[model samples]
Target: MEPWPFDTITPEEIDALTDEEKQGLDAAVAAYIGECLRRRGVDPAPPTSTPA
Candidate 1:
């Protein structure tokens, strides 16, 4: 995977991204988080049902 695009960004900078760019960034962030969780032996799956 490629390196992350930015080390830090302001809200205005995020707001300036195009829809496609925003989607790409969102996916990248999610993947990065999932990988980190996996490395820590944490399950990343969502619960199958909500708690009562």
Candidate 2:
């Protein structure tokens, strides 16, 4: 991945990720953002899952 500016990454860069990598990144970022929101008194909705 390119160096720095992670928060402003472009879609073309994200498109380089494999399916599994994309899902993993999505989950990680979601968790991090959710935690940050909760820390600031914003209650995030409960996570839901669907069977593959």
Candidate 3:
């Protein structure tokens, strides 16, 4: 897989989220990035996602 371009995330998404939802989304994003780094040289994380 490739690195995600977080720097290019759209302003539309910023506007779409409520303040509380945005806080949770930000936490989820940080977790995802940490997960990506941890898997960088090892087997990929399984795709059985914990859904919203």
Model 3 ranges with Cα > 4 A deviation: 1-9, 41-52
TM-score per candidate, chains pooled:
0.69, 0.66, 0.53
TM-score of 3: 0.53
Better of 2 and 3 by lDDT: 2
Q: What order do candidates take by lDDT, descending?
A: 2, 1, 3
What is candidate 1's lDDT per residue for 1-52, written digit by digit as tens?
8765677876779889988898788778778989999999999996466322
After superposition, which runs of candidate 2 have C-alpha atoms over 4 Å from their true positions? Answer: 1-7, 46-52
lDDT of 3 by residue, 1-52 (tens): 7665668787688769998888788778868876887778655455465445
Model 3 C-alpha lDDT versus the unseen true structure: 0.72
lDDT per model vs. reference: 0.80, 0.82, 0.72
Backbone Cα, N, C clashes tallied per candidate:
0, 0, 0
lDDT of 3 at 40: 86
Q: Per-residue lDDT for 28 in model 3?
A: 89
Q: Between the candidate structures 1 and 2, which one is better when assessed by lDDT? A: 2
Clashing pairs in 1: none
